[model samples]
Target: MYWTNYHGHSNYCDGTHLLEEYIKCAISQNVKAYGFSSHAPLPFLTNWAMPYEHLVLYFKEISELKQKYAGKIQIYTGLEQDYVADFNLIHKEWIDLPQLDYIVGSVHFVDRFEDGRYWEIDNTTEVFKEGLQGIFNGDVSQAIQRYYALTREMVQEQKPPIVGHLDKIKIHNRHEHFFDESASWYQEAIEQTLQTIAQSNAIVEINTRGVYKKKSKETYPSHWIIKRMYELDIPVTINSDAHHPEEVTREFITTAQVLKDIGYKTLRVLWNDQWQDFSFDEKGMDLK
Candidate 1:
């Protein structure tokens, strides 16, 4: 474990720990670099995000920590930019701002309605099947189509450096009862999404947050999606989405082993506006 972890959180957002706590945890874990990616401040985004008012403070804290631990470890600052079409209009302004090391582009809200409000969308068969049936009044297929369309739009428009947890909304559907993964329409949507990601040259993350939640058997993107990604040769990175110190590198080794089982030899890491491959150690992937 050379100690390079890019997905972590702090008191600035929903994370339970402070920035310093996570840094101390990284030092104890012997990690070389730890990146903090709290939920980005979205002006019009719903109440679930860190307010824009805290941006300066967020930077201040990160800067202070960076100075304090300069030689002991590497600390990078970032945000998990939520992929909303309207939000993209000012995306570059935010991405280009000061003190930002990188970003993890994620789509937590599938659609935003009038009044600039959004609802939680579960892109799975079971939840969406029922929710769509009720919310859209029995037009479940249309909802499913819209969900995929939204996903594709995010990939095309945002073109993030890394796609966060490709199939995150499916976390709780381990029994496979939600939507039919075998269904032609669903399968096509997934295939198209993967192709778009590969074409975008974006690194896909094997997020283990859901696994820690105990809601799913596999990490984000699931085995089905991961297998297809392997076939397509799309680049990948591992993230814990940790909100606390102890959770900083949770399940990283297991996730690495899983990737190894699927024939992945290296993982992507960001540096100088590009992603490069780093060899995995399997049993010793996180020895730091």
Candidate 2:
């Protein structure tokens, strides 16, 4: 059995290693298809996102790696774009360019700080609290509401091919001090967003980075939310959201078993220039 991963990073972004290191590690992990989805250039100046100027080189480098790794693995190029509508990043014409194989849209920020900086929700505990109180006047419900609203808006209008880390705003809510996931309002928001995703062409990715990093006990979207996605018949793909070479397929096998337990029988994979669903188990997919 072999794995297929479409979410990964390299030195071009915040990832620790170069592109080739991830490819070599993926081959060792028996990955048949791997995609490099480094964080795309953002409007704000941040150390994590790739620089806008590097996009040309990012595409150029991935193109070369594909040929060099031919017969060893299938490589695809993608970007983890931040869908910040206020900055018009999501509507930028450059996103739909031919150089990209796919886009994994994510909502990392809700509103902006008084100083015009966007409030990133999944950052450190102090930053998260600052946004919660400063932007929303300490109204946790309102903060969470806006986060999901941005998600719904992105999927409805942008319709990114893959939605990254669906419930990542909860990254700082680890202790449930802000709000309860079982609360009616929280469930309603998730239900509405998942319903929208079910209607759109986007695929929801079950990200394992949160779990492996100990920032979250479960994968993004949580186990119960995943079960709800199954009931809604939402298409899903498992991704480690790897930022390091050895993490290409981190937590993948256990995450697969968790998916299986939630009643998922197939996973969507981009292979041979097409997106298709393949039967999968704890080990990997039955591509043969």
Model 2 misplaced stretches (Cα beyond 4 Å): 89-91
- lDDT per residue as tens, model 1, 141-178: 46556666666777787667778878766653565555
Assess every candidate by TM-score: 0.87, 0.97
Clashes of each: 9, 0
Badly placed stretches (over 4 Å) of model 1 are: 45-47, 113-116, 122-135, 138-141, 172-176, 271-274, 283-288
RMSD of each: 3.1, 1.1
- For each candidate, the alpha-carbon lDDT, in order, equals 0.75, 0.89
Error of 2 at 39 (Å): 1.0
